[model samples]
Target: MVGRGTILGVLGVLMAACGTPQRQDSGSESVEGRVIRPAGLAFPYVKRPACPGEGCAYGTWLACDTVSVYAREADTTERAFYLAREEPFQVLAGAVHVTRPEVVVVTRPTHQIGFQESGVLFQQGDTLFVLDYIAEGFFDAWYRDSIIETEIFWPWEHWYPAKDYEYGGDVVQQGVASFWIQVRNGSGQEGWVPADRASLASANSLDPDPPRCPARAE
Candidate 1:
């Protein structure tokens, strides 16, 4: 009969030969062993809505398991989402391979102001113009409402239409100086109003830069 110690020793050897339990591939393409980040590669994480069934929306602030990794390359950055398990390395590796042939990354700074800095305050029945100097045209306008309003304007558009404008926000980015102001109408919808149409609530309120209009013919 085998001694207890001998039997236990044999069992230990058998377990070692079997090796660590193989990780079940969660149907996702992943490596079986340790994953290492490539040299000189940097990835940044961004927050987004989690999977619908994961119950992340109602849970902790950062309870979402879905992580978006932006892998930066020489000229371009590739974006990928990974389902984080115990580790994110394996998922990252897979993302990097798929997004090869790096794409260039372009970034810009956004400037935001508060209510105090909003160009002017206007009331209902005022008409405001959406000016575009480059196009030399007034594309759209807003009919002011009664409620206090805010606006968010983009700097790039030569002409930004009021219909496309965002309302009820305190952020105003560097955009063309067309006298974009915030106003509300009877429907309670607020938007950017042109300074030319609406009179400022106070001279002390923020003022818009002079309109960059085309020069008059001699």
Candidate 2:
């Protein structure tokens, strides 16, 4: 039979290889990385230490001091949003420089709301840039919400072509729709357009990453 020590040692190696992170505590070290989270899809970024109250942003995610969600799941109803710098590095949506050790991600609040301020934050050289680059390829991004008893017959728009990235066919949805990604620039300018008609990069422009990530099916 395998000894307990041997079994534990094997488990440790497997966890490390899978990149399972250890728990982080407060006042951890700061991290930095290049904002290589894909150019086409806008990323949701917010400042650290968000406050809750009447002044808080709308909706459920950022509505409280903590970052918990009310999604339907048995074993995973609420997950803690880490305020530490190291935690965000694990869930970065895009690939960063393989040479940069890791994407030392920080300020990843549990909820992501799309606005002009949506983009990943990273340090490139001495500059602090907020990248709002939208991908060139066109895909259907849905904006959905439920209607209560009084909200029946509410006018809504659905994507007909869905490829043009245009919304028309104003009608009512029976159930509800999911959240949609709306691009906003650092200057507070907003627009929802096709890939060809997308607004310019929100801040300090980044030269397109040679070729896009082939693995990204979206």
Candidate 3:
């Protein structure tokens, strides 16, 4: 018979080796000779509706928050956008864009620990956009509630308090994809755009030389 201690030890080792379980769709891939995994941000404590019918004991529930992570080719500066599974790094280059290339700064948020530290910067005409770096990860939080109610006893009614806080939100899986960029257009309007929509600026020049239009054949 296997001992309880032995089983726990083995489980601990397995968890340590696996680190965090990644999403099923997110498999490991190789990029520039380095192994990359899918990763994303995870939000916890989102309110959700409870199940319907008499079987449903809990009133309301919480939902899980899942986000995708993406990456792009490294630029001339050897900087690239990656997930926050590991340590933070700097990305010196931005992706190519239709408009003039602009210098963008990528930095990890100080609040996000144990995650990547890279972001993208875009400059379109006089408008500049910044995408603050956030690590791709998730966590599970448990919440509970206690209720007081009247119970039927032998020839009498009794008051009792019940506890029912054993519900766990949702499982968080690890994955990677491009982060979203916050855009502030020339008109001062702000919006969120996916990282893939615009390429990072390779050069810092506000008005880089534009690609010449092709000449039509006579």
Candidate 4:
């Protein structure tokens, strides 16, 4: 029979191998890279301390305080997992479960696959603020209440073409019906054209003033 310790060791190895992650670009510059000091911050910025003692068990975590670790799940749920300053943990799957309020989790093997460094894992319970960079492709924002607000881009136009012709139509005389006017692509972009300036010939352009001529005898 396999011992519990052996099973745990094998599981840990498997997790370490498969759970390794690539540098996930959250599209946020701050979270996209390595952990660095927030500029203009004071010294001795009390980080959630690492596990001071050895042999700390999993789920042994710190309190919720400053930043936090959250996952946008497949079901579209944002769950927060409280973490300690020093526990190293990688996000495998599922919603985060937190006992303490403001704890961060540190990961092992530093920057390898399945290894995540100290992730800020505490929530302030304040109004969650999110900045969406539309240019950068953030179309939606997720809230703790599980409400997702999405933004869509729509452009407006002043004029639209009524018709479309595959090839330019035959050139017609200035006043001829077949002149510059031709059907355009229905789905094409809109552009404006002056009715009067459609053709250089007198026929195409409607005369501003009417010439009153007597009717010819039939």
lDDT on C-alpha atoms for all candidate structures: 0.21, 0.19, 0.20, 0.19
Q: For model 2, what is the C-alpha lDDT against the true structure?
A: 0.19
Candidate 3's displacement at residue 143, Å, is 26
TM-score of each: 0.15, 0.17, 0.18, 0.12
lDDT of 3 by residue, 1-218 (tens): 11211211111211211123222222211122221221221121111221111121111111111212233221223322222222222222222111111111112211212222232121221111111111112111111111111111101011122454221111222112232233332333333323332122111112234212223349
Better of 2 and 3 by lDDT: 3
Writing each residue's lDDT as its tens digit, candidate 4 over 167-186 gives 11111101101001111112
**What digit string (tens of lDDT, one per residue) describes model 2 on residues 92-119?**
0111111111111222222222333243
Q: Please give, for residues 1-218, the per-residue lDDT of candidate 1 as tens digits.
A: 12211211211211112122222213222222432111222222111211111110111111023333333321124543332322212110100011110111112322333234444433222222221111112111111211122232332222245686543221111111222222232343332222211112212112232112223359
- Give the 10-residue window scoring lowest on summed lDDT in candidate 4: 171-180
TM-score of 1: 0.15
Best by lDDT: 1
Give candidate 4 regions above 4 Å deviation.
1-82, 94-135, 140-218
RMSD in Å for model 3: 26.6
For candidate 3, report its TM-score.
0.18
Which candidate, 1 or 3, has the higher lDDT? 1
